[model samples]
Target: MLLKPGRGFFFAIVLSSVAPVAGATALAVDPMTVLIREYSRGNGSYEYLNSGTDESYARYILDRPSSPYANIKWSLLPSPDTPTRRAIESVSTQEHPVNLRDLHDMKVWDLGFTKAHIASETFRMPQELRYVPGAWSIVKAGIEPDIYAQAIRNQGLEHPAMTANYALAAQLLRAKLAATPPSLWKIRGLRHDVLDRFVGGEFMLAHDFHYLIQFLDGALATWDAGSTSAYGFRQLPAPLRLGRIAAAYRQRLPFEHEPCMEDDTHDPEHAGEGTFDRRPLCFDDATDRAIHVWYAHELVQELAAIHDRANGAPTLAERMAAPLRSSRQGWIGIPRPSAIAEVTRIEVVEAKVTGQLLVEGDVSYRDAFGASRRALRLSCGMRP
Candidate 1:
């Protein structure tokens, strides 16, 4: 969550001779569909001028026996009536279609539509929504740090090709932040946003793929962040999963800045549509609360390694420093920040989690600065 945002062109490839083998480290993202979204409209209207699939990734899925990512959903497969193809059709009448051959610059940042699709206002199709695992969101950072952390956690070791780019992205952001002057250190703090361009950027920077299926699959087996309704409407799973992952990793996760008053909030889906009333938010997955704490405990250990490392422990930080990524650039490798010396880093003055709480806030959007503030805690008088 401490990484920074970047807007620059990157051109590099990491080729590998590794083959898919069941039970071996591999990723299962097949000719992935990359959204070439040019614009987004009101009323959820989206226009994707073009998109393409990575055939190599597709083959990896077919060859691999185990994978965490849901296998090629029927909708993702290329066919005459595919969503991506149909999406491009919608934009054709408005402007000339963007064909695969027409993409002259695949260096991510160089694409004409890179910044547009990265913004939340832009549109995205179902396939683009699922395929694009946002890794770098520089502009529409709903809340910078949270976005960066979620993206890191969401890199749940699935979709090897995508993970490779995330690793690269993490490294890039960290390097730039570390290089900044001390006075400007505050400018480099992490942020959270849902723009899909970050994921799209990672897709273009990918070198290859693998599938470490089933790894950490059970980490949350005893927990369920959320699920869909009978009508197929899904819920936000980040809050639920974030606490659990932090606990699983045993990271002493920080709570969101709690608001003074608990009040109503707006619904994110129908924001300007003036549909739902504002309501208070609270974290109440008590069934898994204790484990959540446990995961947070583990997470902090990894974070510690990032700040100080001698390269001996086989921990997450060490592994991240040198990840199993096939990409030329790897994990957001942490660098000694230039201003860290002058900066007052977070320190343990008096830390305790005896009856700790998991403060929850409005899901409509991140409550970062001011305005309508809200907070709800998910903790109780019980022991794990």
Candidate 2:
């Protein structure tokens, strides 16, 4: 019987690292049977296992410790009768199996898959959906600035491995930023589409993954813009548990962009086949909403830092120079599009516990058109 579409109903699951089960029946049996046996034995928790090619299994892994089957374990054998073996057989028949190995040798700019996947008539899986995280993606996941901030606010101390991951991600991001002709990075502008180029061209996975990637890319972009050095960002988190939770969820955390609207609206099982409506997009989804809130809090903290630094200067010259100094040497590390000549005034309109902050101010800056003063209004997830 086809299981009802739930967190994990096998559409396709990719299994890697199949370990040998110690003792099991030689006869072929369904995976559900093993699941039942374990449940019957009253094991409250079991090891997580990967098998199959369907998204039910993929989404199950995407949900992680939050999923009902989070603790369950099932192993696959060389025998073709196993569910995992069947999935491998199934994927082998598909014209486009979600494999990154095939695309590795291709240059990021020359990648044809991004346009191809977007233009395809039928839905195809993106690389972010893979249960086993790609080496490129694992490195990309650790470079998140907000993740570092979250680590600071909630915990102070990163796992050695996570620190290593973040450090690697920073190094790669810097290399990518530096190697990129200034023109291309400007063209990319820190968006989801950059994943196609930046993280190794793979199919667009989930909108949530794209959303998070945008944030990380933006952070690195600031580094490129001379806001702060990589070493400076590391200094802030060196004492905090920045990557401890991430360490527990390593590899998994990077691809956990599930519960995204793309799955809800586009997947045949969830939204009904051929009903393809992109209108119910990421911004409307619950998970993305929470992420937005987190980003909002981070923004408030950033703006608050700017306000405190600029307003605290004892004299007008210092006050006017405060923003520029902060931009160059401050801890907040946000990027500025143009150099600030002076911050004339700052008024905090509102600050809320819900992670919303509103501030409006008069600012003077020189750009290509020359210097001018204007009122700048800043709000989390809002403008004007």
Candidate 3:
């Protein structure tokens, strides 16, 4: 059922006795253990997960050996949150019941995020959290769905914000799938291509470009007119040249030293204390290379068009502007091979979010073959 604002407190009380699934053979250790280990190490605080009133309840719920998989019976409850809730309620009341297997390939999927709030607050790392060597292998082999279902059942839809967040996630995933390449054969150099194809011909490399554009557009739409900074103009790709010209207009100029108060709010303990440290935003150099390569290809097409012109007497300006007839032929700018050659090494740091899946970690790429480089931290929610 879709949750509604101001009704979460009562809904939580109605579904308190639901049991978690048991007998998951794919996972060596439970999901809660992994989340605790990562959070404790990153925050450098022991009691954050282990020694609280929340920890006692978590141990009671998660430590038991039982199968937590059960279709949520939203029909028995007195009040459902939305009209969508009535639809799910009707389905649950059927004589022939639906199961998790039925939802595997379903297009309209909703994964409630309120589960994270409960897991983050209650779960403690087991004493053997660090000793589970085969943990990741098990998760990758497809054991996360059950763990996720268990968490969702445990946290029942209590907040409308949770439903809204999940709806956004569903939209993003659908968009990504729709833009995916139909087949690997259509994409050049399947052997050399670093990006993976999914459904259409659009490369994964182009996904981040669209995200950056959206970010800039949203900021500009909501920006204050009195502010001194240029809003929409900042969407232009960072300059390739490392000279004074590039440094003068870099995007970092706007928020380089500014405190990342927004990101710190994720942690409630350090909310007002300002204890969380903000890392520098590292722009992807590979994106710059792709942009330049696109430009160089356009230049070649323009040169060919000039040679095809029959009169052969047009001024240089007209010949130079011939490619502007097609947006695809727009100037990409000069090719910069140095940027491609700058990347040195890429390392992945794995962090567990809810004990079910190991989300994306920090990916550090050294530039100039170790001469100089930068690091970028990514979240699992961010598509690769």
lDDT of each: 0.23, 0.25, 0.23
**lDDT score for residue 242 of model 2:** 19
| lDDT by residue for model 1 (19-138), tens | 111111111111111221112121111111111112222222222212111122111212222433433444343334433212211111111111111222232333322323221121
lDDT of 2 by residue, 176-235 (tens): 566677768767553424333324323323442334333433332221111222222111
Query: lDDT value for candidate 2?
Result: 0.25
lDDT-based ranking, best first? 2, 1, 3
Q: How far out, in Å, is residue 73 in model 3?
A: 17
Estimate TM-scores for all models.
Answer: 0.19, 0.22, 0.20
Which sections of candidate 2 miss by over 4 Å?
1-72, 75-172, 178-384
Model 2 worst lDDT run, 10 consecutive residues: 107-116
In model 1, the Cα lDDT at residue 353 comes to 8
> Number of the top candidate by lDDT?
2
Q: Rank all candidate structures by their TM-score, best first, as comma-separated numbers.
A: 2, 3, 1
Report the lDDT of model 3 for residue 11: 26
